[model samples]
Target: MFLLKVFFLLLQVVTVAVYSRADIPPPPEPEPIEIIELPLPPVASAVEGSCTSGTGCILQHAGLVQGGSFLPDGNHVIARVNYTGAPAAPDPASVYTGDQIILVKADGSSFSNGSPFKCITCGVPQDSSQGKTEALDYPQAFRDGRRILAGTNIIDCGEFDLVSDECTPESTFIHPIRWNTAVDGSGEGGSIRELRLHPDNLHIGFNSFTYDAGKLNQYAYTGRLALNSAPTTGLPMAPRYDLTNVNVLSNNDTRNIPLIVDRDQIRINTDAITVGEFRGFSGSGKEATYIGYPRESSNIDVFAVDLATGDVRRLTSHPEYCDPIDISADDEWMAIMDTRGSNRQMFMAGMRNVPPLTDIISTTATSSTRNNGQRRFFQPYLLDHYGDRDDYYGQQVNAAGDGSPGSINDPQWNGMADPRFSLDVTRLVYWQALVVSPACGGENPLPCPNSTEPGGRTERLMVAHFTSRQPVPVTDIEPLSDTISWGTPYEPGTVPSRELFISGGVYTLYGTANGSAQVTIVENGDAIETVAVTYESYSDDGLTFLDGTENITVRNPTVTLNEVDWYSDLTQRGQTNATKKTSPDGFHLSIDVNTNIFNANGTLSTTVNGTLYTQPANGT
Candidate 1:
């Protein structure tokens, strides 16, 4: 019975397995493998050679171009290309291409002239447009013409029509537009009227306006967008001017009427108004200008708006044409490009004198006198100005100050003129338009020196100090590569152990300096003795304050400002790196304390607890 049951089970298994195998049919011999094809990707390459319209040369890359210019700050150069071959305006549907202009720095790094290149970084392609071009007329220094404003926006080429419909039906295609520019690091962009960057609040003069009917007959105004003590305060301060019926007669007789608008003052209930004097009045306090062709017209005026008092001041009223004008903090000085004729010059005026404030101190039992420094006022000096020659306004020619007769290379014709000073009043720069003689008339005869003569500009950067004072070279400051290692003076060959990781001392318990320094103290609680181990060197001397104390304590904490003393004996000049050390209780100190303690004689001294310590004539 067991054998029969096993046989039945085996037969059933064999039947089921064979039925499944027969239906599979050996997996159909794996089928003859089939192969499929894929489409190829499009390849791209740069346009190899330059092509002009009607040449029938198709480039790997081509397009119509719109115009392009270097941004005012000269940061990034952009080249815009419109496929439309003509000078026609942008049709919203036209295709355009843009390329970023990049510059390689002295450090071997490349930066964009502006926009996507600054702050952020990127790799750029090399092309012929990367070099300088002579076709562009860029901004030159107001004085030193040779300085050749470093970062200039230059546009070299432009492309026209690319689309068949946009191009004239019978005409062919032209290339695209390309531009190059350099942006100065000084530019900061925001859609505001004023800028107050710390340490460099007035770096780029914007936010202020100038109006001049004539000297003193004119008034100047600046936007005090942020007033002291009150963030809620608005515009229009004292010394207001109403621009009603005001007119300026330029030497060239060109007249401009400004448009004015009034808006609600943010701080007060009244409305603050700004005259629509210029075309591009983006609230960002940046200056803009348009120079007259060949000669600049100095006819200019600015309306000042008071946010708080709804007042307007017409800053100036002068017959001469004015171009560049800059105002100072506290509304004290007004600097401008004054155009008289042969005397196209720069001028400054003192507006107001700052005052000193005093506060009384009366104790319960006694009274003492505590005087803070009084504010001193200075009279404004007239800077360089070049006026018109003969009857021609804005014609470059030599002029004199106070109507004195100054000789040009030939005073009768065009010569030394257009002097502009640096903001610090340290250097005077002037422009001399020269008519170069052509050698083509042989070295002998030129074309009678006509107005078409190639005119050149000159600028000079001078070191100007006060009268009887020699100009100092404050630039090109070199850094000190090596300084003496400092710490507690130690005995020769005695490897001193420090409770702190690196620095340790045993003589003084005066005080300690706080910072990222590691420190440790050890004492037997017996000696009240004091030991001062200081490493001294000659440095531009500064001041440190301290309070009286018997314990090894630090008293007054001293802060160092960059105010330099010309008399200091510190060998190195210009900006220098400085470091200091003081005690934990605020009494001990170490510094470049020996250099300029005396402002007159350049003497060397170190002050400790109100007592000046004189170092040997030549520091040890």
Candidate 2:
């Protein structure tokens, strides 16, 4: 029985081996593999190398556009443009080659002569009997929309009228004005760094230098003139032009009388409100305010001085350097640029109620108490906070010695400057330089040959829209939907659309939107409505995409009275008119007025009573 079982087991093993071999069959012949190639997509080419439509475009040869201000209607911009090369030396026979003041559309099209506006005094040599023509520097649009203000390298400060295409020189201080000269041969005074026209359009504030007792002194002075004043036709009087006699608001004299508010410290509100540096009281009312290192330390804090009373109170405090840029139309908030952190950034602070005069003049207060009190006046909140990604704005990492060939590539890195608010306070505009490259070439941390050198940067004019009635996180700040190199560098005083007063009406403005983006209008702390706006990638030849627009939904949209024709349909129909006015606090209130009607007898009748009431977003 054992022998028979062993034989059966051997047979079973042989059978299993045979079956496994059968299942393996012969290895199939290797099958041939197939490969396929796909065609590449077409490349889109730009029209004339110009970016006509898109989220952003680069204006390759637009020259250096500086000191830009949007027109009152936000349709155009006025700026100072310096052509690609340095100006020729001033010569009596040579043509004036100074910088040009120009008006351009939002689409980068020129409104004035596409060429440079002829400089009024460009060809006259410095010592010519005809008097030297000064070069135009900064150009700013007036609130009225018809005029612009610009500073000269000499005594010829003036305004250029858009309608007349002429520059009218204004009354300036009588001093030996010098341009581009070193202290040795140059006159005691220096060129005007800033020229600010008062809101009344009658007075001007400027930063300049004057020789006093063999020493040059810097001052912030005010020049006053009657309303509707124009510059005298010829050369200004010399040695000291006191025709418009300037009052020294702040000076660098030994007495430090009145304190020194540098040009950077002056902020002009829409209502002509001026806040600057003042030094009436010191530690326990002892020392002069403008006596420290950053040039005016003791009096460096911002102050709202009663120009009428000579009374002044501090608005901001120390550790962080604060320079006021602008004040809201309602005077409820102030925008500032401060160096509180590693870099300077834009900030906004609520305006605190002025303290009682009694508290300000108290003599027994300690320095600590005074500083603490001043600190309470403003609680600053950062506006452009980029955290670790601070480089969203350009970084100045490659200085001369940090691995670069020449200083030519030294980056024009900029921190946030020129914080501006719309007249309605619904938008804010500021500028920053963004870095495009860390190193110019791949595999080498050095500038590439013929390429935009390493650390290449571009200036961007950024806009933030306040869409929420309630205060939102700073991170939610809205940049203008489009991207373009929109502004100049280092100009903190130009506020685009700051004076644009759009009365209550509806109108359309262009913006870029994607399918995921929505247009929202918030009223009285609620998102009253939202419209889903879509964008289609458009190509003129089906290869390159262009910018397309979709309608944005707005509730009780506002338009400027300047934009409406009073004699048109509203008056002809004798329709009752009602519109909402937005307060600084974001509340909407209705203002109702009956239209002027032409009586059957042809006499014009005026509406006697207008009503004001709270209104919903739908105007119900």
Candidate 3:
């Protein structure tokens, strides 16, 4: 589940910095929703206590998991964790005696000395902790329920047997068998990413990078795992495994040599099998999934290229960013992490199907915009088997409940890579981290929202349950807004709405509440009065009013004096109650407007509120 596929950008990302325009700042992130623990109902608490608190939750905390998956039993999870309790910790193989492959209860509960976990290696009596460097980034638990084909070798956690609700570890059960990691095992000595083990259990698919001919070339490859009679490599001890019959999917000149006809706008790159990075295999294991060369510039999506036929099918079509994908065993569902509702990429690719040819050159910029500093604006989405068909992006699993922190669907806790489905397809397992400083607060421009996930833990593994093993139906929904990009101080930005929203700030952020309405008078079949009004009405999260609504009533059907405009300024807590009286027929009108000043960014929210009193007959 690599977020940014091109690791070669390590150069540009280190040297250059990307910032949003100063004036039209990135919209403030929503306030932190409070974290509260809720006990599952007795009926739903049937899940095992080893993996959960026995709480059958839609989104349960599966411990402090990072890039891990459920084992063959569909009960416990396996991730390479460190003693420091931090991911990507300092030298995972060197820090705290190098991180060992440990399995913890999904609730992040640790026993004495981090016990109660099924310690497959390191501290177990059957394990050998001396001499060898222990490390793994992508750990794959084989279906055999014993061997783990993780980084560089196979971790034989002989039997994942648990006693007293714990994976009882034995030293004799664990040993490492080194393998020839890649066709060119030259990076960091050896490395592979976005690694996937095919269902056949004999072959594997992955992506790797190699510097060749003074250029850094990254390619996707598939190869068979074998125990060679001869020694594989001198780096690790002998009696090792090797990747035989290796096949490089995108290393050849399969892609067209781009011809820039008119600058970068009209460049020509053929739709060859240009696999950028290997994602994984489809559920059926017939087609291999990867992030292909951009079909539409700046819109990076998932594609399944047939391993046999070389035909390609686009799995996702959203203009916003998406990566970190997994297909269900039936290939009917796709669980992925994305930035659809965050408006994170709205600054770049949110213009929808109408992308500019010139924007083709900015694909890297567009892809990188999915992240900010150390934060990723990703949330889990459940796509149907059809991928993104017309307007149908997958369902946001967490978008359902009231998105309070620690709840199943808290939007503040951003999703992370590699969502895996249970073998039975009843559960989806993934991870997330709360957004904190630098990406939100601190010297960065965005407002500092607090973390409601208590005790200050940043990331956690989340598991979601489905009622049944059926694919969610798909439907198209045209979003309510468009944006104004590339604006500067000389001309500030503008936000326009479609038929769905009022002309306000919904485009700035999704899920923000607002309102719009049109009132008409049909007196004597003549066009007498028509009032069209648009408003901002998010609660305390709103941009305009805060607590309550404003009411106005007028009784004047005979008088006609309609040529006056009026306004009022409200304090932090106040309502405007004004009455206008007109002569001739004792015309009277009362307006009670309740407005909140502290709602959000604008003097209009604080400064002015417009109150009108008029009808078919007029008033002053």
Question: Tell me, what's the RMSD of every candidate?
Answer: 36.4, 34.1, 20.4
Per residue, candidate 2 scores C-alpha lDDT tens digits across 500-591 of 11122222212122111112222222222212222233222232222222221223222100011011000101122322122323222122
* Predicted candidate 1 versus true structure: per-residue lDDT over 413-481, tens digit per residue: 221212222333332222222223231123423322332211111111111112322333222212111
Question: By descending TM-score, how would the candidates be arranged?
Answer: 3, 2, 1
Give residue 385's error in model 3 in angstroms.
1.2
- Model 2: which ten-residue window has the lowest total lDDT? 1-10
Count of residue pairs whose backbone atoms collide, per candidate: 81, 6, 9
Off by over 4 Å in 1: 1-299, 302-315, 327-335, 341-420, 435-620
Clash count (model 2, backbone only) = 6
- TM-scores for all candidates: the values are 0.22, 0.37, 0.59
- Local distance difference test values of all predictions, in order: 0.19, 0.27, 0.46
Mind giving the per-residue lDDT tens digits that candidate 3 earns over 563-586? 111121212122322222223232
Model 3 steric clash pairs: 62-106, 63-106, 63-108, 93-98, 125-171, 126-170, 126-171, 126-172, 127-171
